[model samples]
Every structure is written in structure tokens, then in C-alpha cells.
Target: MSSTTGSPSPDPLDGPLAAADLDALVDEWGDWAQVADLLDVPRTKVGTLLREHRLAAAVPRPGAGQRVPLAFVQDGEVVKGLPGILTVLHDGGYDDRECIAWLFTDLGLPGRPIDALRENRGSEAKRRAQAMAL
Candidate 1:
């Protein structure tokens, strides 16, 4: 007799991390409109960034809509090395949520992968991202 009142099945597209968990890991987030404002581009062009793997966004939590981690941008542009790292992770079959979670997770790096990228030590983060593919 299976019950129908427990937690719902996880969405396959949500990747391995829960939305709340992903939300907790990020300090700041911005929707595409905000991202456009930051990038000084029309809102429509923001979609191009995601398509190019120059940025990654996720719903964060139910009803939260899509949001990008603010750490991925700095100085009015996508942070240097972030695109390459994101590309690597995406190529490794990690979805947007997984990619964001991985970036914020501390796997014995000097800090989280996002932190390393912010500090301009993206080579270290990129190395880990590459290893994930294998």
C-alpha cells in the first residue's frame, strides 16, 4: 500500500540538488532583467549569454523564477574564466542547477569554486571542472 502524501518525486531536470539547497549556497542572485541592466544589454540579449554558456541560471526555488548567481558577473561583464568553467561543467552533463551547486560547493579548494573565480584563481576551478568530465 503506497501512500500518496509524502514528498513528490524530484524533477529529473532539477539535477541532483534540491532548489532550497541551491538557493542557500548562493549569497546573491539576479533575474535576467537585472542581469541585462548589469551587462548594459537589452533584456532579450541576456538569453544569448545563457545559450553561449557565458552564464548559467536556475529557478533557485519553486516560484522564484530563474536567477543567476551575481558572483558570475563583475565589472559589468561575466567574470573572466567563468564561461570556460561553465562550458566544461555543461559538457560534463551537469545541468544548470548542478553547475551552480558545484560552483558554490567547497571540495577542498581554497574556497568554493565561485570564490576562486571571484579571486581570479579560476584555473584551479577549471581544473576541477575538467576532472568532473572524467
Candidate 2:
């Protein structure tokens, strides 16, 4: 499904890397409606999740709707430890787009931070995210 119109503007810090970088880093993204379907919740609940820092979404590119990286959810729930990582990143001044970009970026780990979280190796990713906040 297409993203809704009138999405909010990106944060001022959502730069250095372009939206295209995010697009390349993530293999797939799910719009709010799709994520809602996956979680078996109403579309409004997805907004709640985002507000709670249990999830994040971003517009990957101009003309595209806001979307969440498909990797953030597994089965019918958010991947374990993802909310914690998102909190760490957000506390460090990263808006959703920056958080998504950082998670998908490889920083000499066995894989991207998101992969580390998915593999239950979140401690290292959390540490790195903590450092990034400095």
C-alpha cells in the first residue's frame, strides 16, 4: 500500500546520509497498514507503538509513504530487544529515519545492528548505539 500523504517533515538531524542510503540499506519496508496487519492490530495501534518507542517508521524516499523496515517485526511481534535499541538511539538524538539508517548500517559488526538484534546479539549493538549518542 502507498504511504499516506502529508507525512511530517524529517528532523533536521536526518541528514549526512540521504534517503537513498536508507533505501539501499533496507531490502524491504512495510507501510503502517501492513505492519498493523502483521501485528493483528488496528491501524491506530501502530501509531501507539511508534509513540511508545516500541517501533519506528520513516519515509524512505520522496513520493514514498512512511514505512517500517520489515526486519523490525518477526512472527506477530517486534523482534526482541528492538525497542530497547530504538530507545538508545532516540535518546542519542536520532530521529526515526536516523535510527533506521543506523540499524541497517554495518559498523564492523558481524552484520548490521538490526541483524545483531535479530540474532539475539543485541548487547553489542546496544553498546554501539550508546556510544553513538555521545
Give lDDT tens digits, candidate 2, residues 1-134.
Answer: 87878856443235553343677778999999999999999999999999988998988877898899889998899999999988887887878888888888876688788999888888998998898888
Which 10 residues in a row give candidate 1 its minimum summed lDDT? 11-20
Candidate lDDT scores, in order, read 0.83, 0.84
Model 2 TM: 0.84
Candidate 2, residue 133: how far the Cα is off, in Å: 1.0
Deviation in Å, model 1, residue 106 alpha carbon: 1.3
Please list the residue runs of candidate 1 whose C-alpha ends up more than 4 Å from where it truly belongs after superposition. 1-20
Error of 1 at 45 (Å): 1.5
TM per model? Answer: 0.84, 0.84
How well does candidate 1 match the true structure in TM-score terms? 0.84
RMSD (CA, Å), each prediction: 5.9, 7.5
